[model samples]
Target: MGYPQVSAREQIIPSRVPTDAKANALEIGPERTVIEITHVGVTAEGRAVKVTIAVAPVHYLTAGYELRSPDTRRSQTDDHASR
Candidate 1:
């Protein structure tokens, strides 16, 4: 078989936030989110691949929030779809 093609990979290339951007803390509000582009590697001889090898801001459940929930229902508690 032949190799796959490098399709268009869309990304949000925002300006790097400074240290004092949010008083030295990345505050992910209820409607806010954060992500990190972990690595960009080439595979199978120049097949470009971008890997976001990181998790969200709230990786751990400090408060009464759950780290992993199977609740697929949509509610006002924690809406996955922002809009």
Candidate 2:
């Protein structure tokens, strides 16, 4: 493939608080939710092979984790799936 396709992507993949649905998450801020500006780049050279890029956000150090219990972790997982 040579620059044939560009897929649709969602801007805001919202995350809610474990206990409350109305609360905002620490990872994604309320002010930075909407993307005000964007920059796009294209390859100067045409490629023959297809390109698939997979990206994930991993947090190595969270500010608050001492307060979370084992049950809380389970609830957060459950809440994430249900929402």
Best by TM-score: 1
What C-alpha lDDT values do all the predictions have? 0.44, 0.36
Please write out the lDDT profile of model 1 over residues 1-83, one tens digit for every residue.
Answer: 45554432335433233334442365544444444334445555667665554334433223243443446443645675675
**Model 2, C-alpha of 24: deviation from truth (Å):** 53
For candidate 2, the lDDT comes to 0.36
Which residue segments of model 1 deviate by more than 4 Å? 1-29, 48-50, 58-83
RMSD of each: 15.3, 18.6
Tens-digit lDDT track of model 2 for 1-83? 54643322223223222222211433443333222112232344533234333222222222232354779889999999999
TM-score of each: 0.22, 0.20
